[model samples]
Structure formats: structure tokens, C-alpha cells
Target chain A: MLVLSSPSGAGKSTIARNLLENDKGFELSVSVTTRPRRSSEIDGVHYHFRSRREFDNLRANDELLEWAEVHGNFYATPREPAERAMNEGRDMLFDIDWQGAEQLREKMQGDIVSVFILPPSMRELKVRLQRRAEDDAETISRRLANARNEIEHWRDYDYVVINRDLDRAYQQVLSIVAAERLRRDRSLGLFDYVTRLLDEQVD
Target chain B: MLVLSSPSGAGKSTIARNLLENDKGFELSVSVTTRPRRSSEIDGVHYHFRSRREFDNLRANDELLEWAEVHGNFYATPREPAERAMNEGRDMLFDIDWQGAEQLREKMQGDIVSVFILPPSMRELKVRLQRRAEDDAETISRRLANARNEIEHWRDYDYVVINRDLDRAYQQVLSIVAAERLRRDRSLGLFDYVTRLLDEQVD
Candidate 1:
């Protein structure tokens, strides 16, 4: 499991796309949200857009592993699908925060490996957020303030990558995901099956 | 930081040495212990062999992070020296158990990545122990029993690698260390420095 969380415009969305495009075993988890879609965003593909009432129902039904309100809107992961993917030995990638990562960790045992992406600096973060030209000045100021608070919880993650250089950050995250997949606890079945042949030779 | 732990003759020592040889920026932490030196072992290089009285004094004074009695001998890490190395930006590697790893985590605010090496199987573990040809059959049995208990704490570790195929296991560990060293928090200075350049350009 891999969770790549950062403030908006931190290049995590780009990094996530490249990772899923390159890696065969990984599936990007599409989140459901009540947030309004941007001009380029698509439903059921970019996000599973739902009404506030539906999101509220999911929260009430205990269906979400983790959920959060952002900019007066809601977003969440449907718990069952993610668990089913993990159980079948597929890796799921999440673009979420500490709250979601923590909840996922509790539900899964030794599977979640959270990586927090830090912008080069608060100044650079503001620049990147501004470069998008999507949010207004007030919204950008609000985001900068939120980013600082989010980054303070960087210690909660298993790994952290500063997105100063996009190529380097992408390569670092790719290596982490690849290395984690080969962990002995996760690949025990492969080891056991191979060792049986060696056992037969000895017997 | 990476800690590799396994029972004696489980090939963890060999794996640790291989990782050290191939990886740059990783230094093996030389431990100070009160154990009698084997004929082939070197002093100060392998271990700082201390007197029982000195070991007891260090343990009593709280200089040692974690110490354990095994076969009537004591072994521990002097916390100050290890912290100095880490503070100097060196990734100190440990060939220690879950107990020592836990102790290090509690005392230090640095990152800890533990890898538990599993023998191919219990049968192979027994074979590997017997192949050591150092211990008698009774001692080998005791070591095998101990390995089982150690493996039970596999969940406590962040990563696990099985030495089924030496080359594969070595590569897996190498990749993990490489990825961990690139963690964002440790590279914060680099990010801040780079961001300053960008800030200057914009101004």
C-alpha cells in the first residue's frame, strides 16, 4: 500500500499518474467526494462525485475507512473495495492526508506505507499554488496556512519526499514503492514456494 | 537508519555486511559489550570488549540504550556515540534485535527502519545452524528454538527479508536503504537551500 499526500499543487497528482502508468501491480484508488468538479475533471474517472446526503450516508453507515471535509466539501474512500484489492495482493495508491493514512493503518496490518510530500518551502508552496491560477488570492492564502499545519504531521509518515525537483521526487517515490513490495512479509509465499523445490532435493 | 536482526547463523550478519559494502553513506555501528572475544574476533574493530564491572556501571548509569544477557555475557549500545554519528548525518546500521531497535526509537527522534531476516524455512534454519559447525547439537537446537521466538516478532519490524536467494535478498535490502536515505525530513536542508535560490530568482 502507498499513500502520497501533499497540499494541492504539490505535484502529487502528476507523480501518482506516472506511478500507476508504470507499475503493473498498483491501482490508483478513486475517491468519492461532494466537492465541485473543476472544468477538466470527469466523474467516475477523476472522482466519484456524490451529493452531500450520499456522503453523509456513507459516514453514517461506517463505509469509509477515512473521510475529511475540505473547502466546505467532503471526500472519502469506500472501505470494502480497497481491502478486497489488498487481500488479492494488489497494491493500492492513495492521495490522502494523515487522518486517512492513520485510519488505513489501523484497519490493515503492516500493509500501509505512507509517504508525505513536502514542498521545497512555504514560499515555493505559495508560488506553486499561485502558478495553477485556479484559486483566488484569498483561497491561496488559506491553502498556505493549511499546508504548514499539514506538514507539521510529517513525522507520522513512513517516508517523506520533498518535491523540490520533480524528477528526483518521482524517482525516490518509485523506488520506495518498488522496495516495499519486495518486503519478506509481503513476498513470503514466493519464498516458500521456491524453497519447497530446494527441500525436495534434500529429501 | 536500518537495523537487521536475526538469530546467530541465520545469515543476517552476512546480509548486513553485503549491504554495507555496496551502499555508501551507511556505517555499521560497532557495539561495546562485556562478552569474551572469540579467537578470530578483533577488539575495538568488532566490539569494544569491556569489563563486567564497566558494563554493570554503564547499565546502572543509563549510558546503554539497550542491554541483554545471553550465555552469561552482556551487550549494549552506548547512546551518546550513536547519536553523535546520526547527528553528523551518517546512517548508522545496527545488527541488533527488536529490543534494541525499540530502545533506539524511544531515545532518538530519528527515523528507524528495521528489517528482520528469515531463514528459508525452519528446516533450512536448522540446517544453516548445523552448518555453522561451531556449536554442538544441543546448542544448535537451543538456537533453532530461539530463532522461532525471534521470528514471532516479525510484525514489530517495518520490513522483513528472507535469505532464500542471497542475491535477491541483498538487492531488496539495498533498495530499501537507498529509498530511506532519500526521506524528505532528512533532506529538508537541501530543499530549503534550493527554494531560497528560486525565491531570489522571483524577487
Candidate 2:
């Protein structure tokens, strides 16, 4: 499983989107949230919007892999899809925050490869946030404050990518995925492959 | 440091040579060996040829990072060059056996990224060995036997690449190097970078 975490406007979302589009083996782990879905959001695509009761039930039943309560709403990663993806030999991409990445790593330490992305500078980050023009100045101020907190946990990740250039950051992410896939412990097929090699006639 | 280890005919030497030629940041850790230098081999380029007395002196003085006596010829990696390369912010490549890899790892556990290359099949390995026509059939047979012993320790490596296609395996290795460079623990600059990010004024 690949967990991608970054502060808002760090270009992680763009990189994640590109990875999903380009790599067939990877499927995003759509989160389940108790927050009201916008008209632009589709159920099971953007998030599986659920009632507070249902969210509580999932939490009680241990169906949530990692969860957080933010802005009086619950957001969580459902356990079933992630387990299924791993069993099926498909890579699962977790588009989450630092807290979510931490929870997931705690649950699945050996399986998780977490990456944290950082903006090149605070000025560039503020510019990117303002470019969206979706938030008011107060909201932007709150986000910048939140970003400092989020970036503090960059050391917890296995890899850190500075998003100075979108393309370069994305390419670095791709390279990381490729390299992690080649890790000897993860390649279970190597056992039988090596055995076959040893048994083969080499005369 | 990148350590590439493989049994003979697994294409590791070719990949190492290619990496040096293609990447400016990497420099091969030319080993010091007590073996007789071939007519085609250049001193200090292929290896730093030394006498048994000199090799023993270096070993006694603890100047060797990793060393092995192969078929009675002393082959050893000098510690100074690798330390110098690391201190200078240049990547060093170690083309060594499993024993040497283990020694190097012990000396620089956090810095060394070890990879083991495997040929697609034992037959293919034998074919490549034969194709070289440099060694007699007896020598080829001995090498094939030795390869099996070497391959048994593949589990010790961080990453394993099966060399079915030379170019593809080489590319995988290149990707590993790129990703390892992005590891958060390895990037010492990140501490100051993150500090700067947090301290910056955002209006």
C-alpha cells in the first residue's frame, strides 16, 4: 500500500491523480466520510458518504482501517477494499493526511510505504492556495497555519518529496513506487522462481 | 552507497558500468585486489592491484571496508575512498559479493542500499557464461555451481531484480537509486528546509 500525505496545495493531489490514471495496477482507496457530499461529489467515487450512525457502526465493528474526526464529521478508510487489494496483488493508493498515514502505518507497518510532499516554500504554497480562489483570506490563513503542523510529521514518512516542480515530484513518486515493488521481501514469487532456477539443468 | 551483488553472468557488472557512464553523481568504489592484473586491465581503473603484504597491511590497519580472499587472491574494498565519496555528497557504487555486502552494511547500515541481481534461469546463466568463451568448460561448470551458492543468499538483499532482459533490469536498478535518494532519513537537508518552511511568514 502507498500512502501519500501532504499539506493542501503541495501538488500531492495532482501527483496521486496522475498515478491512478497512468498506473493500471494502482486503485485509490476511496474514503468513507460522514460529511455532507457536495453536488459535484459522487458516492463511492469521491467518498462513501454515510450517516453518523453508520460511521459509528463501522468504527465499532472495526471496519475502518484508519479514521479521524474533523470539523465535527468522521472520515475513515474502510478496511475491506484495502485487504482485498493486497490479496489480489493490486497496489492501493491512500490519498490521506499525515494523521491518517500514521494510523494506517500503525495498522499495517510492513505493508505501508508512506510519502510526504512539501511545497518548495511558504510563499509558493500560499500562491498556489490563492490561485484556486476557492477559499477566503481567513480560510487561507487557517490552512497555512495547519500546513506548518502537517509538515512537522514529514520525518515519519519513508520518503519525502519536495514539490518544487510538479512533473519532477510526480516522477520521483513514480520511481519510488517502482523501487518499492522490487523490494525482495515483497516479491514472494522470487522464492519459487529461484527454486526453479536451481532445479533447472544448466549443462 | 549502492551495493550491487549477483552471481557471475547475471549482468550486474554491465549495469554497474552503465550506471557510472550514465550518472555523473556516481563513482565506482574500485576495489584493491592482490590478484594478478590482466593485460587488458588498467591499474586504478579496473582495480588497485596490490601485493599480499600490502593487502595484509591494509587489513591489519583496518583500512578495508570489506574484503574477501577469493580462490587465494585477496580482494578488498578500501574504506577511505567510500567515506570520501559519501562526505563529498557523491554516490558510491560497490560491485561486491554477498560477504562484502554484509560487511559494508555492518559498517554503514543506514547509508548502504543493497541490490541482488538474478538471471532468469540457470540455463540462461550457463549460456551467457559459455557465450563469453573466455573461460574453459571446466571453469564454466565451476562458475555455474558457485552461482547456485551465491543465489541462495538473495534474501539478504534490500531489492532483487531478475535479469531476464538486461535493459529492463538496468532500468529497475536506476529507479531504485532514484528512490533511495529520496528517503527522508537520508536527506539531511530536509531538517533545515522544513524549519525554514515553518518559520516563513505567510500573508
Candidate 3:
């Protein structure tokens, strides 16, 4: 599984979307959130919109892999899909914050590869946020404040990509995933494959 | 620095050559060897030819990063060039065997990224060795015997690429290097970069 975490306006969502669209091998981990869905959002595609009670119940029962309170709303990753994906030899991608990423790392350990994306500069980050025009001045300021705290955890990640250029950042993320898959510990069939190779005739 | 290792016929050399030719960023770590230069080999380009006494003196002085007795000839990586490359923020590639890789790992630790290449099958490995026709039958047989020992060390590497196709293998190696360079620990300027980001105005 691959986990990507970045502060707001750092282009994690764009990179995640590009990976999902281009790489057929990856399945996005649809998060469960208590926040009200936007008009443009699909129930399952954007998030598994949950009632507060349901979110609490899932968290209490350990059915949620990770849960956090964000902007007064609860958000989480369901446990079942991610576990099933691993068992079935399928790859999963998690677009999450540092808290969610840390929780996943605690639970999944070596199974997860986490990357943190940094904006080119705070100036660029502010520009990107303003360009998106998704938030009012107060909300943007609040996000900017949170971004500093979020970036403090950059060293927690296995890899970091500076999102100076979206295309280059995306390519870096792609390369990390590709290389991680080839790691000796992750490639399950290697032992058997090597055994078969040893059995082959030299002549 | 990147180290690529494989048995004689597993195509590590080909991948290394391709990387050196295509990527100007990487410098090949030319090895000093006591082996007689082949008719086709250039002394400095292929291997730095050295007298047995010179090789022993270097090893005694710990001037060799890693060394091994192969086919009764001493082969070693010069310590100075690799140290200089790392100091200068330049990347070097080592086309060495598992023994050499392990020594580099022991000495450099996190500074080294090692990759192990595996031929698709033993049959393919033998075919490639025979096709090259560089060594006589006895020498080829010796290499085939040693291949099993080399394959056992695959788990020692950070990454493993099955050389099923040369182009694909080269691409994988390229991806590994690109991603490794962006690792939080390796990207030395990241601390200052992040610090500068923090100093920017929130508004």
C-alpha cells in the first residue's frame, strides 16, 4: 500500500488522482467521513459519507483503520478494504493527513510506503490555495497556519517530493511506488521464483 | 551512490553501462584490479590495472573501499574517488558483486543504495553467459557454480530487479535512482528549504 500526505495546496490530490487514472493496478482507499458531501462529490467515489454515530461506532469497534477529527468533522479509513486489498495482492493508495498516515504506519508497518509532499515555498503554497478559490480568507489563513504544523512531520515519511512542478512531483511519486514494489521484502513470489531458477538446467 | 550487483550473466553490467551512458549525473566507480587486462579491455576504462604488490598495499592501507579475490586476482573499489563524489554531491555507480556491495554498505551505511539484478531464469543466465563467449567452458562453469551463491544474497539489497527485459530493467533502475535522491535524509538542502518556507508570510 502507498500513503501520500501533504499540507493543503501541495498537490497531493492531483498526484493521487493522476496515479489512479493512469495506473490500473492501484485502487484508491475510499475514506469514511462525517463531513457533508459537496454537490460535485459522489457518495463512494469522493468519500463514504457517514453519520456521526456511525463514524463513532466504527472507531469504537476498531473497524476504522485510522480516524481523526478535522474541522469539527470526523474522517477515517475503513479497515476491511485495505486488509482485503493486501490479501488479494492488489495495491491501494491512501491520500491522507499526517495523523492518519502515522496511524496507518503503526498498524501496517512495512506494508505501507508513505510519501510527504512539500510545496516549493510558502509563497507558492499561498498562491496555489488562492488560485483554487475554494476557501474564504479566514479558512485560507487557518489552512496556512495548519500547514506549518503538518510540515513538521515531514521527516516521518519514507520519501519527500517538493511539488514545485506538478508533473515532476507526480513522476517522483510514480518512481517511488514502482521502486518500492521491487523491494525484496515486498515481492512475495521471489523466493519461489528463485527456487525454480535454481532447479533449471545450466546447459 | 548506487551499487548494482548480479552474477556474471544476469545483466547488471549492461544496466550499469546504459545508466552511465544515458544519465550524465552518475559517475562510474572504476575499480582497481590485479587481473590481467583482456585484449578488448582498456586499462583505465574497463578496470584500473594494478600490480599484486600495489593491490596488497592499498588493501593494507584501507584505501580500497571493498576488495575480493576473484579467480586469483584482487579486485577493489578505490576509496578516495567515492568519498570525493559523495562530498561533492555527485552520485557514483558501483557495478560490483555482492561482497563488494556488502562492504560498501558496512562502511557507508545509508549513503549507499544497492540493487540486485536477477536473470529471469537459470536457463536464460546460462544462455547469456554462453552467448557472450568471453570466458572458456571451465571459467563459465565456475561462474555458473558461483551464481547460486550470489543469488542467495538478493535479500541484502534495497531493491531487486528481475532482468526479464533490458529496457524495463534499465527503466526500473532509473526510477530507483530518481526516487532515492528525493529521500528526506538524502536531500541535504531540505532542512533549509523547509526552514525558509516557515519564514514566509501567511497572508
Instruction: Write one digit per residue (lDDT tens) for candidate 3, span A22-85.
Output: 9999999999999888777899998999999988889889899988887798889999999999
Candidate 1 chain A lDDT trough over 10 residues, lowest sum: A194-203
lDDT of 1 by residue, A43-89 (tens): 98788899999999988998888888866888888888798898787
Rank by DockQ (best first): 2, 3, 1
lDDT of each: 0.77, 0.92, 0.90
TM-score, B chain alone, candidates in order: 0.89, 0.93, 0.94
Off by over 4 Å in 1: A7-9, A32-43, A48-80, A83-90, A96-113, A121-158, A175-203, B22-24, B33-40, B50-65, B86-90, B97-113, B129-142, B152-158, B174-203
lDDT, candidate 3, residue B35? 87
* Candidate 3: residue A183 lDDT (0-100): 83
Model 2, position B202, has a per-residue lDDT of 72
What class would a CAPRI assessor give candidate 2's docking? high
Which window of ten consecutive residues has the lowest lDDT sum in model 3 chain A?
Answer: A194-203
Candidate with best lDDT: 2
| Model 1 steric clash pairs | A160-B184
Model 3, B1-203: lDDT tens digits are: 99999998898888989999999999999999998888889988989999999989998998999998877988899999999998999999999988999889898877888899999988888889899888898988889888988998998998899999999999999989988988888888888888888888857
Each candidate's fnat: 0.32, 0.94, 0.85
